[model samples]
Target: MEAWYMDDSNEDQRLPHKLDPNVPVTLEELQKIGVFHWKLNADIYETDPELQKIRDERGYSYMDIITIHPDKLPSYEEKLKMFFEEHLHLDDEIRYILEGRAYFDVRDKEDRWIRIAMSKGDMITLPAGIYHRFTLDETNYTKAMRLFVGEPVWKAYNRPADDFEIRQKYVNSLAA
Candidate 1:
C-alpha cells in the first residue's frame, strides 16, 4: 500500500497522477482520519490467522468476494461510475484485495484528497461515513473480499450526507 496527494489531471482514472511535488501520506496520517490498513499474504488469506483474528475481533460475520473487471461484472461502466462517485456508507467499508490493484481516494482532515494505492495482499477498513471513492488502477482489474458485521448493506449516500449520525461521528473523531 502507498499513499500520496493526487494530481488534478483529467487523464484516465487508472493512471497514477501523483502530484508534482509528491506529497506522501503516511500510515499514521491515515489512522488519524479513521482509515486503517493491513498487509497480509493473499495466497493464504482464507486461513491466515491475522485475518481470522481481525474478523473475529471486529465481529465481521459476513463476507463476499467481488471481481471488478469489464468482463466479469455486468454493467461494468455504470458500476465504475457509481464507485467513483464521492459517497459514504452507513457501515464500515472493509475490503481485502486478493488480486490486481486499485486506488481508494479519501478526504483528509482538511478535505484534501489522499489517494491510497492498493494491490494484492492489501487490506483496508474505511470507517463508516467517511467520504471516499474507489477505482481500479492501470490494471483495470481487482478481486476483493468484502467483510461486514451483519447482513451487507449496499446503499451509498452521495456526499453532502452530513446529516447522517455516522457522518457526524466520523467528523467528531477527526477532532479527537
Candidate 2:
C-alpha cells in the first residue's frame, strides 16, 4: 500500500497522515485515526464462512462487487463521477480490494488529504462521515468488495452540507 500527502510534489516522500517525516507512524497512530486496515489471505465472498462470520459480527447485511475499468466503467460513468468527487456516507465505508488498485483520498482531522493506495488483499474501513473520495490508480482498474450493514444505498452526501451534522461531529471528536 502507498500513502502520501496529496499536495506533496515528491512522490518518494512517503508519510502517514503527513504528520512528520522523522516520526514514522506506529500502530497507535493508525488506530487513533479510526481507519482500520487488514490483510486477507483468501478471496472475500459473501458466502465464505470467515467473511460471513465477520459480517455477522459487524452487522453487515449486504455485499456487492464494484469493478472499474475502461470497458466496464462506461455504464457507470455517471456514478463513477460522483465516486471520484469528495463525499461522505451516513454509514462506514468498507472495501476489500479483490483485484487491481485504487486510491482512497481521506481527509485527516486537520483536513489534509491522505492518499491511501489499496491493492489486492488490502481491506479498509473508513468511519462514517469522514470526508473522502476514491479513484483508480494509474492502472485505471480496480475490483473491490463493498460491505454494508443494511440494504446498499448509493446516496453520496456532498460536503459542506448540514444534513450530516451528527456524523460530522463524531468525526470531529476523533481529532481531539
Candidate 3:
C-alpha cells in the first residue's frame, strides 16, 4: 500500500523516479546498475523442473506476472509504489529481472546507500546486511524471474530476512 501518485505535477517531481512507467528506456538509463556478469539458461525458462516447481509455490505465483502496464501511463508511478512496497522487509532482497530494467537502492557495507541499475536478463545476488528498494524507470515495465525460500516457522531468526535466506540445498539443486 505504499503507492502514492498525485496528478499534480509539483508533487510528482518530489517523488522518486519521476517518469510514469514503461513508455521506453534509453541506453543512458540502462547503464545505472553497475556491471554484473550473469547469464541465462535458455533451456530452463520453459523446461526447467526446478523453476516449474517454484512457479507452483505460493510466493512465486503471487509475484510472477508476465504482463504489466507501460511505465509511461499516468498510473505507472502509482503501480510501482504498490509492487515494491508489498514486500518491503530487508531480510532477503533476492530478485532478478528477466525482461526489463529496474534500479535498486541498497545500503552498502558502510551503510551508505548505493543505487545500482539492473537491466533485463541480469541476476542480482544480494548479500546480507543490505537494505534495498527497487524502481522501474519511466515508460518501462518488466518480467522478472526470482528465487526465495518459504519458512514453515521461525527458528531463531535474527530478522525477517533470515526467513528468506536461500538454503544451500535449494541452491545446489539448480542446474546451471
Clashes of each: 0, 0, 13
Model 2 C-alpha lDDT per residue in residues 1-176, reported as the tens digit of each score:
65655664544222223544522333344557777787674363545676667778899888888788878867655655667688888778889898898888777767777778788888788887778888776677898999998898677778874457756575776858
Off by over 4 Å in 2: 8-27, 42-49, 75-78
- Candidate 3 stretches greater than 4 Å from native: 1-37, 41-44, 48-63, 66-76, 82-91, 151-176
Clashes of 3: 13
Leading candidate by TM-score = 1
Error of 1 at 75 (Å): 0.8
Residue 88 CA displacement from its true place in model 2, Å = 0.9
> Model 3: per-residue lDDT, tens digit, 1-41?
01221122434222343235423333332223221234354
lDDT of each: 0.95, 0.72, 0.43
- lDDT for 165 in candidate 3 is 42
Name the lDDT value of residue 25 in candidate 2: 36
lDDT, model 1, position 152: 98
Q: Is candidate 1 or candidate 3 better by TM-score?
A: 1
